[model samples]
Target chain A: MHLAVDISLRQGGFTLNASIDCWSSALGVFGPSGSGKSTLIRVIAGLAKPDSGYLELDGDVLFDSENRIWVPPHLRGIGVVFQDARLFPHWSTEKNLRAGMTLETTGMFSFEHIVKLLELQPLLKRSVNDLSGGEKQRVALGRALLAHPRLLLMDEPVSGLDAKLKEQILPFLARVHRELHLPCILVSHDLPDILRLTDRLVLVRDGMVCGQNTLEGLVTQRGAFDMMRRSGLMSFVSLEVDGEPVRAGVRPDEIMLANRPVEGLSARYRKPGVIVRLIDHGPTILCLIDTDEERLMADITPDAVRELGLKEGSPVWCFFKAGAVHSFD
Target chain B: MKSISPAEWTALLLSAKVAFGAVAAVTLPGVLLGWLLARKNFYGKVLVESLVYAPLVMPPVVTGYLLLVLCGRNGPVGGWLGRTFGWQLIFTWQGAALASAVMALPLMVRSVRLAVELVDRRLEEAASVLGYSPWRIFLNITLPLARSGIFAGLLLAFARSLGEFGATITFAGNIQGVTQTLPLAIYSALQMPGGEAAAARLSVLSLLLSLMALGFSEWLARRAKTGRSTHAPCR
Candidate 1:
């Protein structure tokens, strides 16, 4: 399904002006906090009315300011999984799931299929107030899926979760996309969370769509890279070694330093580079190394930096394993 | 532990009947108005709110006088009702029930409105996305979640109705078997010579009734609180 949105709205002092069109099944919206990510999703979900512009999904006009056509949220057939998993407090898990089934649609998602897909059989009898955060999110996903929505919208579904819970939920999101084949828009401020779900991203900043590109493509853009760096996205590089293309993401924490290239080690990718800059982080130092093809950032401890006498213009051998490299086509 | 007399028995039964009638009369409108006050924003909201709560702040006699002027035989509303429905609200038990309902409405609205406001609006938004109509959302989600507050409001209104007097006396006249509720009976018992024993006995009954109502409300509130905490998996 193709989705098109071009909308502008002003509330108080914050204004949102964004326009994008996407045909990809899973589109990730990445931005920092207070960056109008939620506002965009709210507009598409019909929760917030835009001052002007038009929205079309799969050839249907969802909203058109000039034409004065606006479909209410319920009739739009768009399902949203909110960050807080806003389940009805008075209902059991089963009832909450059943409440999402649209009256006019049936046989799309059966109760048993949803229960098994979300592993909700054990939680069906439990009160919504009794479920954990991860469980609540899972139930919310089931609820939305059971609605047989034409388009799915997720707003920071795993933002507040710990590492373990996030890991547990991300796979379910991927499975939902793959198994259901539903078009979805996932909004998050976390780069890794968006990477886990989809590679196609729309970068948003200051209530505007900066650009839409792949994660690798985004790193190459100057302004987008600076925004990503400020938001804690590590530098990624795509290179060609021995006439074979290689794509790898270098995490700031994984890059180790050595004065000379050591032999008898399992680390596959070792490159000799000159230290271009050294930035003092709170507890560690961020050292930027100028390799032949690209620049790599290494986070090294202050003690090690002092021991090695590392400074700007120093030559160092950067070592990392092939396993640490995340490759994409 | 004196045996109750026949006159006292009639007054007690009448009080229960009047209180029940008053509560029944106000519940649906009270809840609707409470939800409107809690959720909707419109012109004259403050004026509407003040009018709803006028009975609570104004003198009971004044409220009674207003009700008499509005619903008396010669008044516009009373004349229309008499002509259209052949209904009479003056100096009858129904009039007493109406007066009691008006007196208790503000408290009922306050409790219910507070509860409705406390309900997480996000839940309603989620329900809207799930294809539930506005009325269905209220019936299926809002009302059930606001049950505890509604219960508290009902009990409070019942207690206030049982003890209503000043408005009841002015609007519905204190006829023995018709409009004399518990508080009115107590007042009547005290006005006669050598009626101290009856007055004291009726006062004790009123005290017991009030305690029971308050105790039940407290218990329900505790249960609702515990239910919320026990089921809440997060802080």
Candidate 2:
């Protein structure tokens, strides 16, 4: 499937002009909050009309202001999973899923298949209000899949969820993208969530499509790296782990500190580095460690800093486990 | 307590029929108007809203006079109906139902409009993305979600119609066994000598009927509020 969008919309003070052509099965739209990521998805889903431009999906003209052609959302065959999981409160989970399935679309994904895919057998009889946040999102995904949409738009499906719930729901989202082969444009501010879903990224900033490339390619670009850094994303590195070069990322919080090299530990990597700077990060202190090849930030509690006598130019060992590092690309 | 006479029984039955007819007459138009007011933004929205609520604030006698001017035999709508369908509403039971409907309309519309307003617009947008047509979305989402309000509106209208007095007396006239509903019968009973016992009996019956209608309305609203199955099953 292919989608070509070149649209511009002006809403009060925000003007969004985005142009993207994507053919991947799943594309990630990564940006900070208030970056118009959701607006871009809304326009693609036919929920909003752009001021000027054309949108084509699989050679079908979904919208073309010059041609005066605009297809209503219902006719656009695009299903959207909103951030809030807007389920029909009055309908049972089964009914909400069935509400989107037409007779002709049933052949695409059978009811039994969706029920099995999303593990919705137990939730079928429950009302929407009875389901938990993760359950509701699964039901919403099933409902969207049942519609036989040519493309799916997901707007921060897991942002509202806590860390544990995010981990629980991310696998299902990836499974859906893989099993259904549903082309999706997932908008999210979280980098790990985007990386876990799709490697191809569309970076959006200030209502513009800043860059579109694979994660590795975009990370090398100075503009994209700066944007990611500003958004609090940790830097990634190509590390030789077990004789294979893997692209790995270590979060600031996951990096432990040691005054000297201590053997017989569970952590896989331990590198001695000099403390370049120490910055206060609210309750925790962020120590900028200058390793031989790269600078890594380690979050240490204020108590640890005082007890360890940590200061700039102090020698320290940064410890992180291989399991804690997320490998992408 | 004096036993209800045949004339009083006729008045009671006629009152029920007129109230039922009024509720039936106002339901469709009332819901349509309520939805329009809740969802649409037209040029004369404020004017239309004010006109709809005029009957509630204006004296019943003024509403009756306005109905008379618009629907009397010599009036435009009444003349058109008489010529086209041979239907005359003046000085008849149908006219009393119409008068009651007009007086109860504001309550019905208000309940329905509030209910419609409570529905989340995002749900409607989600429905559109699910490939539901506009009419289907309204039918499956908006209408069902607002059902409690619609039902409350119906009961309110019915109760108001049952207790309607001034508009019915002025527009349809108090004719025995025809337009003389419960309230009109009470009025007539209190006017004559030695009619105090009859008036008391009719008042008791009216009170019982109104109580039953209101009790049912409260029960329905409560059920609608708590009927959803919220407890999850054993995992």
Best by lDDT: 2
Which candidate leads in TM-score? 2
In every candidate, what fraction of the native interface contacts is reproduced?
A: 0.56, 0.70
List the candidate 2 regions with Cα displacement exceeding 4 Å: A230-329, B230-235
What are the per-residue Cα lDDT tens digits for candidate 2 across A1-329?
Answer: 78898999999999999999988888999999999999999999989999999999999999999999999999999999999999988877888888798878767678999889889999998888888998999999899999999998999999988877776678788888888888988899988788667878899999999999876566556688567655655645457788897766787777899998989999987778899878765677767788887777678899999999999999999888888787754
Cα lDDT tens digits, model 1, A1-329, are 78899999898899999998988888999998999999999999998999999999999898999999998888888999999999888777887898877567777668898789878899988888889999999999899989989889999999978877876688788888988788889999987677667878899999999988876566556677667666666555565556688766767777789988988778777888999887765577778888887778788999999999998999999888776776543
lDDT score, candidate 1, position A187? 96
TM-scores, one per candidate: 0.83, 0.84
Docking class of 2: acceptable
Q: Residue by residue across B76-169, what tens digits does model 2's lDDT show?
A: 9999999999999989999999999999999999999999999999999999999988888888888888988999899999999998998888
What pairs collide in candidate 2? Answer: none
Positional deviation of residue A243's Cα in model 1 after best superposition, in angstroms: 27
Instruction: Give the C-alpha interface root-mean-square deviation per candidate.
Output: 3.5, 3.3
lDDT score for residue A18 of model 1: 91
Docking class of 1: acceptable
Deviation (Å) of A246 in candidate 1: 17
